[model samples]
Target: MSIFPLDHRPDSSQISEFFQEVRCAAMEFVFPPACMMCRSEMPHRIFRTAGCTLCDDCLGQLDSGHGNACRRCGAPVGPFTIATDHCILCHRENYAFDGVIRMGLYRDSLRVACLMAKNPSGSLMSRTLADLLVDTQYELFSERAFHAVVPVPEHWAKRLIRPHYAAETMARQISARLKVRLATGILAKARWTPKQAKSPPVQRRQQQKDAFHVVGAGVQGQSILLVDDILTTGATADAAARVLKRAGASRVVVAVVAVSPPRA
Candidate 1:
C-alpha cells in the first residue's frame, strides 16, 4: 500500500518561493554574482538569513560585534571594562531608548562603508549593511520581537538636496528580513533642524526638542527597532525615541550600522 500520505497540501508561499528561485537561476547567467561591498565577482552566493551578497574578504574587513560592548550604548569597550550595569561612559546619561545595538564602532573599513551608504546610489549598500547588522546580532535581535521597524526620519529640506535616505532603506530591508511591519509613518520630523554636529553642547538638546512628532497611533504598546546609519552622542536617537515612547511605544531599541567612538 502507499507509504506516503496523499493529503499533504503545498503552501502558496512555498510555491511562490519556488517560482522566485527559478527566476533567480535564469538571471544568474546574465548577471554573475558579485559582492555588494567591493563589487568583486563571486563564484557563488549563499543567501543566509540576512540575504547578504558580500565577499568573504570584504566581510572580514567589516568587523561584526564579537568583542565586548556596552549594554547601554552598544559601543565597543575595553576587555577590562565592566559593562554589567551600564558602560562607564554612558551610565549617567539618560536616553529614551531601552537599549542600543550596533554592527561595530565607526572606524577603519567599517567607517568607509557607512559613508558609502549615504550616497544617492547606495541602495544596495544600505540594504546590505542593514542585513549585516541583523546577521551579526541575530540572537539579540530575535529576543527583542520587534513589532515594527522605524527609520529616523529626515527633514524635507535634506531630502530636497539628496533623496537617498539610507536610514529608511535600511529599515525597510531589515523589516522584510524580520517578517515584521515597516512603520515609516509613525514618527516624523516636525520641522527642519540644524545639524547636531555643528550645534553647541548646551544647544544640542534644545535643537532636538520638538523636532519629532508622532503621526500614527498604531505604536501603542509596541516594541520598535529604530534604525540609523550611525549613532553619535546618542542625541538624535534619543530625540527620536523620546517621541516614540511618548506615543505609547512600550520600548524603543536603537540599531545602527556604526557607533561613533565616544567623543574625546
Candidate 2:
C-alpha cells in the first residue's frame, strides 16, 4: 500500500491556497537574492533587483569613464605611454562625428545589461538599462554639442522580429531628459545585413557601406547625436554619418554604451 494514493487529491480551492502559502514561504526564505554582479542585495527600481543582491555601495563603485580616451573615438589610452588626446585610429581617418563619449567599458555588468536589452523576453531589464543610458548620456553630453537624438535604424526584417531596439529606446529617454526633440525616422536602413559579431572587420565595413539612407526632413545645420549600443570598428557609425551628412546634418556625433577594445 502506498502512503499517498495518486487518486487522492485535495480540493482545487485548498490546493490553490496551499501553493500560495508555499510561494510566500519560499519568497521569505529568499528575501533578497544576490545581485548578478556584486552578489549583494540590489537597490530599488533595478530590473533584476529581486534576483540581484548588489547593494547601493557596490553599484557606486563601478568604473565609468573614458580614461584619458581619444577625443574623437573615446578609446582608452595605455597607462605607461604619455597620454595623447586622440587615439591612433581617430588620427588616421577623419570621421563625420565632431566627437564621441561613452559611459562605461563593455564588460562586466554593462555587458550583461546589453545582452538583456537585445532579447524580446528581456524587456524588464532592457528598460532599466535604457534609463541608465539616458541618464548618463544627458549628464555627460549636454555640455558638448547636440540638437537631436537619432538612433541607428534596424533593417526592416530585424525590426519586424524585434521592434524595440535599445538604441531607439535610449534615444527617447535621453530626449525627454534633455528636453530635446527625438527624430527617429531620419535614418533608414536600405538593406538587412548579417550579424556583425561574426563578420570580420573588413566585411562589416563593406556590409554597412550602402546599408543606410537618409529620409524625411533634413537636419540641415543642426548637430545630431547618433545613439547605439556598441561601437566596434566605428564602421556602422561612419556609414550612418555619411547618410546624415549627405542629408545636410551639420554634424554627427556617435554615442554608445561600449566601444570594443583595440584589436590585438
Candidate 3:
C-alpha cells in the first residue's frame, strides 16, 4: 500500500518549492551569472546548486589542512613530534578554547583570498569561501553538533567602516550548513584594540586584554564554535574564548579560514 495515499495532492511545501525553482530559472535567464573568482561564465548546474563563482582550477587550489597538526590549536606540526599536548607555538600561553579547526595555512592563493575577503567589495568571494570551508570540514562539524556558531566580534570602529562583517557572514553559512543556531550580539568587542597582525607575539596578549565580553544570555552550558577569517598568534581567539567560558559556555572551539605560520 502507498503510505502517502493515492489521492494525496502536492502540499504547500511542494508548491513553494516549485515556485522557488521557477523564480530561480527566470532570474538566471534575465541575468546570466559569471564566476566570482575569474569572471568566467559558470555552468547552469554549478550556478544553481553549488552557488560558487570560482572555476574548478581556482577551487582546487584551496588546500585543506588534513595532515599532522596540533590537536589543540590546529597549527601545522612536525609529523615526528611525539608530544600529545599543545604545539610549541601554543605551549607557553593559555588558551580557553578547547580546539581549533582551520581550513588551511595562510599563504599563496589562500592569503590572497583572505585579503580579498576582508573588504566589503569581496562579498561574493566571502560567500564562496564560506562554502569552501563548510564543504572541506563537514565531517568535523558533523562529529559534534555545536550548540551555536559565533563570529569573533569586530571593534566598533572597524564595524563602522566596513559595510558587512566578513566573519559573521562566514559564520552564518557555517551555521546553516551545520544546522546549528547562529548567535550574534551575544559576544562583542568591549573596546578597540590594536590590530594583532602588526603587534609582536610577546605584546599580543596585553594588547588584547579585556577586548571582548558577552552581551547576551542563554549560553550557559552550551558548546560554541567561534569563527574568524584568520588565526595568527591566537591572541584574539583566546581573548574571546575567555569571555565565552566565563559566560558559562562548556566548550569553545575555534574555526578559521586560514592559520598563519609561526613567526621566526
Candidate 4:
C-alpha cells in the first residue's frame, strides 16, 4: 500500500504546491520577504532565479572574483597574473587536495554571508551559496569526475548547538547538483580542535593532524569533492585530505565558498 494518502490522487502534489504558493504570496503580502544577505526589504521582489534570496546588488558581487583565481588554491589573483596551475600565494605551499574551486574571495558581502552561514539560522543561505557555487563552476567541476562529495565533518560537540552546519549543508547541496554520492558520516571528527581561523597558521597544521577519522571502507578508488565554507591557510583541509587519502580515496578536490586572500 502507498504510504501517503495523496499518492492515490493524481493532482494532489500540484494542489499542495498551489496552496503553498498561495500561502507564500499571502505571507509576503503581509510581511514582505527581505534579502537574506543585505536585509533589504524586497516588497516587490521578482525572483530572477528559483532559490535566490540575495538582493540584485549582493548577487552581482557574489561572483565578481570567480574569473581570476589560482587553480591550485582557488585564491584570487590579479588580471595580469598567470594562475593556470599556480599563483605566487600558493606555489610554495603543498596542499593535500588535488585542486580547488571557489566561488570568490572572503571579503565584503561575501564574507558577511559566509559568516552568517555558520549559524544554524542561516541554513537556507548556506544552501543558496552552495547552489550559486555549483551553478557558476559546473564546468570546472565537470573536468574531474567525483565519486562522492564529503563535507569536512563537524565535531559531535558542536553539532548539538548548531545542527545545521554549513559544510555538511553545502556538501549535501553539491552532491545533489553534481549527481555525486554523499559520503556523509563516512568521515568524522575524532576529536575537537580549535577553529582554524583562531589559531596561528604555524599551529594550524599540527592541530588538525589527528582531528579527523574515516569510518568506512569502499573508498579505495573513490575521487571525493571535499566541501567546506572557507579555505584559510590550507592546513585544516590538508589534514582532512591526508586522512581521506589514507582511507584510500584516490583523489580529493577541495571546494569552498571562498578562499582567504593572501596576507601581505
- Model 3: per-residue Cα lDDT over 1-264, one tens digit each: 012356878788777876776776678678876766567776664244545566676677775433566758878888788784588777766799988887888887888888888888877777678878788777777777689999999988889988987898889888888889999879999898876677886699898878998987767998999999888888889999999999999999998988887666
Please write out the lDDT profile of model 4 over residues 1-264, one tens digit for every residue: 113365465478767776776677687778988888778876453344545688788888886746677878887777787646887777788787888988988888789889899887988989989998998888889999999999999899888887699999999999999999998878899999876677888899889888998997857889999999999988888989988999899999999999887788
Give candidate 1's whole-model lDDT. Answer: 0.83
lDDT by residue for model 2 (1-264), tens: 013357878777767776775675467457745454456654343243432234555455433543555658868777654745467777877666667767666666677667766777655455555555555656557676678889989987888888577778767766676677899888899998888898887898899897999887668887998888788888899899988888888888887777786776
TM-score of each: 0.83, 0.74, 0.85, 0.90
lDDT of each: 0.83, 0.71, 0.81, 0.85
The candidate 1 region of ten consecutive residues with least summed lDDT is: 43-52
Question: What is the RMSD of candidate 3?
Answer: 3.9
* Cα lDDT over the full model 3: 0.81
lDDT of 4 at 159: 88
Q: After superposition, how far is residue 201 of candidate 2 from its true place, in Å?
A: 1.7
Q: Candidate 2 — which residues are off by over 4 angstroms?
A: 1-58, 61-66, 78-85, 134-140
Let me know the TM-score candidate 1 reaches against the reference structure: 0.83
**Tens-digit per-residue lDDT, 1-264, candidate 1:** 012246866578766776776677567657987776778886543343234677778888896544777867887788888644477787888989988888888888788888889889888889888988888888878987899999999987787888689999999988998888998888899999887767765687788888999996989999999999998778888999999999999999999988878677
